[model samples]
Every structure is written in C-alpha cells, then in structure tokens.
Target: MNYSIKVTGLKYTMTIISATELQKNRIKKLVDLLKQCENINQQIENLME
Candidate 1:
C-alpha cells in the first residue's frame, strides 16, 4: 500500500499530495490542488530499479 504524502512550503499551499485513497466526489478539486506543487514538492526526484 502506498502511504498518502502531502507537502507544503512557503509561497506554496497544499501541494504535492500523493494520495492512495481519494474520497468520493473529491478527485477533481484535489487533483487540481496537487498540481500546484513545484520542485519544492515531496516524493523522490527520480525512481530507479
């Protein structure tokens, strides 16, 4: 299972939220917000084998 991760920083709000369980009727708005994150967002910069 992938854990839900959310990161926020200065000049940015509710960004980089990689979620596992997206509740009903919230996908659109939530996804829009997620896109706000830039390089300051969470998650690995690159994935390797």
Candidate 2:
C-alpha cells in the first residue's frame, strides 16, 4: 500500500510517501521528519535569496 502525506508551509510544500506497511504505522514520525526537512529547505531558500 502507498500512503501520501501533504505538508504545507508559508513558502514551501511537500508530499511524503510511505511504500511499506511498517512505514505507514509511523505517520506521525514521518510528518515530524518532513517538517524538519521543510524547515531546512526554507533556510536554504533564505540563504540563497
């Protein structure tokens, strides 16, 4: 099974995917990790600007 999670921010958006059942059960952790990734991406964008 495939699970899609959408995380949206003021200047960025991301889609997280889980391809395994084990990962599906860790959605909350995945979301948190995605949030961290989004923050890092935002910081990179800021540095580039």
Candidate 3:
C-alpha cells in the first residue's frame, strides 16, 4: 500500500510506498539518516569559518 504525510508549515505532499514490515522500517531509517546527514553537513560548514 501507500502512505501520505502532511508536514507542518509545508504545503507540499509526501508519498511513500511499502509492501511489508521490512519495507516500512527501511524507509523510516532512510529518512532519519537523510535528516541526520543534513544536520552534520551544516555543522561542518559552520566549523570551517
């Protein structure tokens, strides 16, 4: 099936597709990793100043 999430303060639509338990967990982990990576990148840029 598919899932949709409405983020706060955003008008865009997010779509996610999954078939089983493993798929859902994997997708969640990927999203978490992406957000962490962004934060770390920002920190690195700030430290270079």
Candidate 4:
C-alpha cells in the first residue's frame, strides 16, 4: 500500500513538472514571435523614411 502511494505521488509530481515545462516553452515561443514582430516593424519604419 505504501509503495502504491509513493508511485502515485511521483506521478503527480511529474505531471506538475511537465505542465510547467510546457508553459515555459509556450512563453519562449511567444517572446521569439514578439522579437520578430519588432524587427519587422523597424524595417517598415526604415522603408517609410
């Protein structure tokens, strides 16, 4: 019974860790997209000038 409880706890911890990692990856992607957008905007401004 104790062994089963330990296994359940470990699985729960792993799920939480993976969820956070997924969120981090999503945030990184968003940041990269923002940077790309900024670069595009700068190029547009230069073209207009």
Candidate 5:
C-alpha cells in the first residue's frame, strides 16, 4: 500500500508515519479499503475490455 498527505497553512511540526505504524493502528480497516479499491479496479478493467 501507499500513503500520502497534503495540507496548507500548517506550522512546523515533527511527525512520523510508516506502513507498519498505519497497519498497527487499524489493519482491518486498511485491508477492507484495499479490497474495495481492488473490486473497483476490476470493474473498470472489465468495462474497458
């Protein structure tokens, strides 16, 4: 999986995040999101073909 974030008007801060950290927080939720994305991708591919 990939992670990215964007924001504006933010003060300097120290932050740390990695895939392992993310999964540890909510692995089930993340897995469900990934599955949903995969299903959508497959549907789009079917339409194109």
Candidate 6:
C-alpha cells in the first residue's frame, strides 16, 4: 500500500509519499529530526545576541 505524509515547516510545506509503512515512519522521524535541528539552531542564534 501507499502512504502520504504532509510536512510543514516555518518556511514551506510539502507532501511526501512512501510505498510502505516502514518508509513512511522513517520519513516522519527524519522530518522530526530536522525540526529539532532548526529549533536548536535558532536557540544558538538567540544566545549569540
């Protein structure tokens, strides 16, 4: 079966598709990691100021 996921971030939004549940879960995990990285970077920038 095919699965679709919508990922939205501060700058943009997009749709992703996967052929299996495992692939979809992996994509979701990666997206979460990216979001965490963005938040950490923003915190660092704020600290610099």
Best by lDDT: 6
Model 3: colliding residue pairs: none
Cα deviation of 12, candidate 2, in Å: 11
Could you give candidate 3's per-residue lDDT for residues 9-42 as a string of tens digits? Answer: 2333335653578877887676666566666777
Residue-wise lDDT of candidate 4 within 1-49, one digit each (tens)? 0111122123211122344667767756655665566667777879999
* Number of the candidate with higher lDDT, 1 or 3: 3
Q: List candidate 3 stretches off by more than 4 Å.
A: 1-14
lDDT of 5 at 21: 58
In order, candidate lDDTs are 0.43, 0.60, 0.57, 0.49, 0.52, 0.61
Instruction: Note each model's CA RMSD in angstroms.
Output: 9.8, 6.7, 6.0, 17.3, 9.2, 5.3
Number of residue pairs clashing in candidate 5, backbone atoms closer than 3 angstroms, sequence gap of 3 or more or interchain: 0
- The candidates, ranked best first by TM-score, are 6, 4, 3, 2, 5, 1
lDDT of 2 by residue, 5-41 (tens): 4344443333445446665557657667877887787
Candidate 6 per-residue lDDT over residues 6-29, each given as its tens digit: 323445343664447787778777
Candidate 4 deviates by what RMSD? 17.3
- Per-residue error at 48 for model 2, in Å? 0.5
Q: Lowest summed-lDDT stretch of 10 residues in model 5?
A: 5-14
RMSD, candidate 5, Å: 9.2
1 or 2, greater by TM-score: 2
Question: 3 or 5, which is superior by TM-score?
Answer: 3
TM-score of each: 0.25, 0.49, 0.58, 0.60, 0.49, 0.65
